[model samples]
Target: MTTESGAGARVNCVVDAEGRVALELPAPVAATRPHLLLRLRPKKGEPVTVSRTVPLEAVADGPARAVLEPLPALEEGRWDAFLLNGPDDTAPERLRPGLRDLRALVDGHLRDRPSPVAVRIPYVTKEGYLAVRAWLRTAHAEAGRIDVGDRSTTVTARLHGATFEDGAVVRLRMRGSDAPERDVRPVTDGDHLGFRFTVDHEDLAAGTAAEGGIWDVFVHPAAGAPPIRVARLLDDVADRKASFVHPAARAAGAVLRPYYTLDNDLSIRVATG
Candidate 1:
């Protein structure tokens, strides 16, 4: 079940070795034991599917609990972590290491080595409006939530329970990796979230392809609520179409780039939360 604490998110995950694990994220989540699953990049033309349930027994105990990869020992006592950048009464390392590790991993997974899918950057931010959520910046964590750890720390997400009306203009900047173009996707629904906004081809400059590039989008949250992963926008090069295949963007060809290029309607649509 998907639950929310402030902005802390509870979702489900399954890896090869582990069966299925329920995770409360925006917080640092590691295994209670060892032996876990690390998300793998699907081979050429292979679908990026993760339907396996990780066995708890495999990770019942050990020096390192795991995910898509084995994590280095965290001296603070944590084995793994995740974050959207929030502050904690605990040490800094406990709250935001996920962002640091993510940067390194994203760099390694550039266009040349990018997965067939795309993933939206977690732990979002706004420049000036209000500090809604944070990972490592303590000054900013006040408005959000936090989860501290011994070997590691877990922070909670700041849930605004915010909303936007239909036809609200929005913008999405890619957080990591590159694409031919950056496209902002705003999907509307009546579910807890109205629509989604994240990047794809339309968000980047023209003629750029999604092989090995990194991109970030800036939006004014006033445009709408934060976006969650839906489907990644696709790519069309030389009149041939191929989809962005990151596991996060497993579904093919629903929304492609340019909600409207050069329109400047969104004001980059990001607010400083």
Candidate 2:
């Protein structure tokens, strides 16, 4: 919440391939029995917080190092980082981002891993404070490369904590409507799937009555399993709506655009003339 980093407590975080966070802190703060506290950013649901104490050790002349175990993963949300100076410290100070090393999360390192996929990425907030982005899903379809063609759009995604079945398909459901869902069978390769579906501009325009509306995307991995929302949340980028822009395809007096929602989920929008 506070814009300025408090108490000059800067932290450099290194996230390993297994989601372990190693923190390098200044010697003065480390000597105070420092504890790391992560408070989830307020949203529509109940608030959550995770706190862990740092084990102090003599570092000779180097900065104090502590590791935050990855067990008991955090919930899916943005968490603000705070540094509690000691056990008696009631008011924890917000930490500033020093250096973030998150290369282990690139290129779907955790793909094909066990069930209940867990991903945590450390990032600097817009307010100049250190925070973390966490995602926990029983089954997830991570949206990858997207190609917007004149007649259709192709979407490639990697599946985690789940596998594709015989009847796997991608579904595009119009928001707030009783319109029938549009389903497209995808090409599956190992743990990856590619969806090439026609973007029926005319039907979209008619569905929304010439007014633009959103179409949420989902992937049904198996017949019995529930459909998983298509999203992109593997790397260090906390937000992708502004950075990942797609070209609009215009046809039949309608304009179709694919975009990522505020929560990084993939969706389509249709506008009519």
Candidate 3:
């Protein structure tokens, strides 16, 4: 979970290791006996709200603080948290650190009831999107190193937290306008796994009118577990010192580069002459 606080007021919060939320606020705020409100709304569906007016003794030191534990644990989804002055208070002034850039409903009469006050703040999780995640008991696939060549591509990887037989079927999942999917049998060397894929330079070019030149690498473990993304786990390479540079691409008047996106999803950039 990500930690956020009120922008105008002195407040800080973090989700602890045990999944409990710890909030710290100014001593003055606690003296006033103002209520602490927590509102979580998923991107879709109904919202969850909780509130309390903690005592000053709850303050660890000079600053006042409190901890909130979800009764049954937060639901699985992208959740937005709001630390407000009152329980479900719609007053603009009562708004604290929350989502900003939300346009005020210009036509309030268009709704069944009054619209809630707008908060002009932006708060996000550590990954920039607050989400309740669920992890599987099975192992996860990790991408190791990629070997990019003029005619083919090779991927080195490992399965963390679980092991499988030598013949576990691995595949490369690609998503784009065309949405092409390919299968490859990875050769296992002890704990390390290796896969090779053929590439067509002309078909990967810009003039080919081929769908978006992007592929999302994915792997399916043999134990019938869900597929996982093949991402860049190795150290990022500098542009000038990329390990998989292809001189043939330059001679062919084309560019083929593989990299990880901002979200750490592995992708390849193929541009034709």
Candidate lDDT values, in order: 0.24, 0.75, 0.43
Runs of candidate 2 with Cα error greater than 4 angstroms are 1-7, 44-62, 177-180, 190-198
**Cα lDDT of model 3 by residue, 1-273, tens digit:** 224453455345554333345555544452344444434443456445533333323433476566555334443222343334444446412323322221222222122211111111123444343222221223445455566665666666665544555445655445546555555666676544344344444444533333335555666656565666654322211111244433334314566666665434466665553
In candidate 2 the C-alpha lDDT for residue 122 amounts to 82
Q: Which segments of candidate 1 are over 4 A away from where they belong?
A: 1-160, 165-170, 174-185, 197-212, 217-221, 224-273
Deviation (Å) of 193 in candidate 2: 5.6
Task: Please give, for residues 16-39, the per-residue lDDT of candidate 1 as tens digits.
Answer: 211112222233334333222222
The digit string of per-residue lDDT tens for model 2 on 141-195 reads: 8887788777777787777777787787788888884855777777788534444
For candidate 2, the lDDT comes to 0.75
Name the top TM-score candidate: 2
Cα-based RMSD of candidate 3: 13.1
TM-score of each: 0.22, 0.85, 0.50
Model 2 weakest lDDT span, ten residues long = 190-199
Which candidate would rank higher by TM-score, 2 or 3?
A: 2
**Each candidate's root-mean-square deviation in Å?**
20.4, 3.7, 13.1
For model 3 the TM-score comes to 0.50
